[model samples]
Target: MNGHEQGNSRAAPSRLRIVVDTDMGVDDAAAVAWLLSQRERPVELAGVAAVWGNTGVDAAAVNVVALLRALGREQVPVVMGEAAPSSGPMSPIGSLVHGADGMWGRAAGTIATCPKDLVAFYRAVAAADTTLLALGPLTNLTRVAALAPDVLRRFARIVVLGGAWRHGSITPVSETNFWHDPEAADRVLAERLPIVLVTRDAHRAFALTHDDLAALATAGSPAARYLAAPMRAYAQVTGRFGEPLNFPDVVAAVLAVEPAAATVRRSALVRVVTGTHGLVRGQSVMGFADNERLAMIEGGAALARLVEQALAEPTLHLGRALAAILAREPDNAEVVLAVDAARVRRSFLCALTREART
Candidate 1:
């Protein structure tokens, strides 16, 4: 059964309260857009914290608010997260990777109010049993882990888009997020709190095809247009290397609600090393076998459907839609599969067409 299920009906989880930390990259924008589109779902857009990864922290913060407003989620708080790793100086990733000003280099003034401290913001809401989705570096999360270990346990789960249980994106073994802040990644993973590390290996399964973008664009919504361009850019870079963009993070966000629709694997003791591909690069080691498995939920179609449904409304992708559908069949895989396939096909066709022309 999923976390939403097997709970007291009277006081069951108050929807999947989530605080998403993003760097405002193209994919990051899409993920945020996906969440914003879910206004009718059970997941609550508690807050959005921007961290420096694909772009500057300031840029990321602006992008978050712009995306929220464009998607009609201006009410959702857009907080500025960590500027960068709280360690030595580091170089920016690349403009092509995350665009000029992170999410299209928009203005920061767009955001209603910038958050004071991302770590503290996360700590406060986490106590309400929210799931923290770390889409960027784990700096804020690491800070929280160090300051209040209870906050880590307060949330039912923490879904991180970084780390590579098997490999990395910048290197053969080290992912960029972990490499940027290995100390933080290591600290967060060291904790045994119910966590799901959507590693590169698992993320590869949710690659977005050109067809997907095309379909989204054809949808003729602001989000669809917003999603189409970056998606196209992502395809360009990946096509150069003949690789697909690892998108497990987006899937993880959706699965945070309906986890039973996935195949989970457990890692008891997980650790991450620092640096680029070298002797002491970012490496993960398992200390012991843990009963808790990282739920490997792979329903591209279902996720695509969720994305579409979330984006359909444009303003707010609340978790009410997912909750409503989920309330009926809380433990049925076939039902989830049906939703997944239908959604995937729609997005795949559109994205695929857009990529071909561009």
Candidate 2:
């Protein structure tokens, strides 16, 4: 049943309105799942703009549709975003870390995203004065800001799951998402918006232990089951390497949902290495003073349990209705319009890539 039809379990109008933009991977999928699981509980979980990181931007949106369906949260549509970075070397989707697809092998078949007009849809839903939870590269936000800087800057807050001052994701000094497109990161970071950065330290801080999954073996909820299989798969990998399953994006997600949970370790203007040269190429550094809040959470077992509980809550989301509509009505005007949009997006990406490098 669509979220619209079945109705959300928690409908408090006072809840905060939030949007999540992601790059689907095992971790990102895990984050998206956590976000939906909290739908209408404390936040509206408004729109999701699926952009690039672990997979192609559109590919992430396809997985988002399937995931939303799995959790039953179709009322909040997933809009496909920038296929490539606005201004840096694209990262190849390596390691089946999330599986061959973006999720637990559920992203194989063809999937359709919200009616073809991604730009319009993204603009329509990512309204001014709303909070934004960015869980991927800064590519999509850069593109949007390029279209309307004022609108982008108007966001009440922008919580990023990127950056690694204390560590790295791709290199010893660079985080994967920021490293993937440092130019875009530079542009987005230069904005006037109040930014909250969930550092890599937060990832290490808010992680899952083998015992956590052991406990989930009995939790009865779609979110728990959805997280269980893939998490177990993840645990198997980390177990062999003797590492914990960290949920950095969830830290950012929780910050978006509950701003009070975060402790801003540093508040400063940030800068990222944009020159295509060394180990510090994507490293994001901070100036001694500013409005951006670099966040970290230090809640031992409590934080872990918070994420576990979130996953255990069911989310109401949509059918593959968009797929069905496209299947039955292949000639729909939206499809035609979407083709044009793709060309525009491609042109923008190409131009930005060239200009940023120069």
Candidate 3:
């Protein structure tokens, strides 16, 4: 059963309270826009926390505010999150995919800010039926786990947009978000919080082709018009690499609000490689012994080769030891093994074409 099904036998809330912790990349902006456009769904975007990933935290916050302004939802507060990863300097790979200004330099300029405490904000929101949608590195969530474990535990569920069961985007075995801050990802997963991991395997299936962008550009809605150019720019960059434009964050957001979007999910013991220097530094190793479907998703021969390669590297010895310990732990997360790609694309496009609800 998914997290929602496993919840206490009580009447479900009319609306889901969501606080998005994002890096505000192009996809992240699109994800937030989709959330705000859920006029018929029971979704309430409580707030947004911008972190360092696609760009610096300041630029991310600016992007959030600017997007909110364009959507007429400026009242939804945006706060700056961790300025860097947990244990190292911020990664520069984000700019290669998202451009230097994160939003293709479209959403620039400053906005008035306040000294909002992330931990304090979580503490307050945790009391409600809140779901945390993490669309970037887990640095800010890890900080919450460290400063206030109780508060972190109080969330109804956390939908994370990272990890890869078969292949990763950043490296051979590492997804971008976890690769940016593996240490933080490791800690958050090990904390045993109620987490639903939306991996690349599911999101990549919903990639946007050139035709999809063409449809959006002519859709004539404000949200679609605002997003079409940046999304097309993003597609251009990734196209050169022979990859389609994937919106992993938007996939996670949809699954968070609409669980049926996930056609296949499994409970598993998951671990992240936290080693500072290794070929698989941020690799997500999932133990799928109990689930035959999961085992099939990650072929045994392939997994063995990955392990063999890791063992061959002396720099990964400590990470291997850490992974061994986490393997013994109970299942910590429900992994989204598959999703309804057509349904997700339709929902995303429909949201973009609709007017934002007040």
- Which number leads on lDDT? 3
Q: Model 2 — which ten-residue stretch has the worst lDDT? A: 330-339
lDDT winner between candidates 2 and 3:
3
Q: Give lDDT per model, in order.
A: 0.62, 0.63, 0.83
Model 3 lDDT at residue 121: 75
The pairs that clash in candidate 2 are 72-316, 72-317, 73-316, 73-317, 74-317, 74-318
Cα lDDT tens digits, model 3, 1-358, are 7787778566555887898999999999888888887654767788888889999898888888888888888788677779999887887888987889798977867473834598887776674489999999999999989998888888889999988888787888788899999999989998999999999888889877677788888877668877888898898999899987788888998998899999989888788888675779888888766443334344567556666877798677745643454455678899998999888888887787652221
From the highest TM-score down, the ranking of the candidates is 3, 1, 2
List model 2 lDDT by residue over 312-342, tens digit each.
7545111232233223312100000001222
> Could you tell me which 10 consecutive residues in candidate 1 have the lowest summed lDDT?
330-339
lDDT of 1 at 195: 73
Tell me how far the alpha carbon of residue 247 in candidate 3 is from the true structure, in angstroms, after superposition: 1.2
Off by over 4 Å in 3: 1-13, 290-328, 354-358
Task: Compute the lDDT for candidate 1.
Answer: 0.62
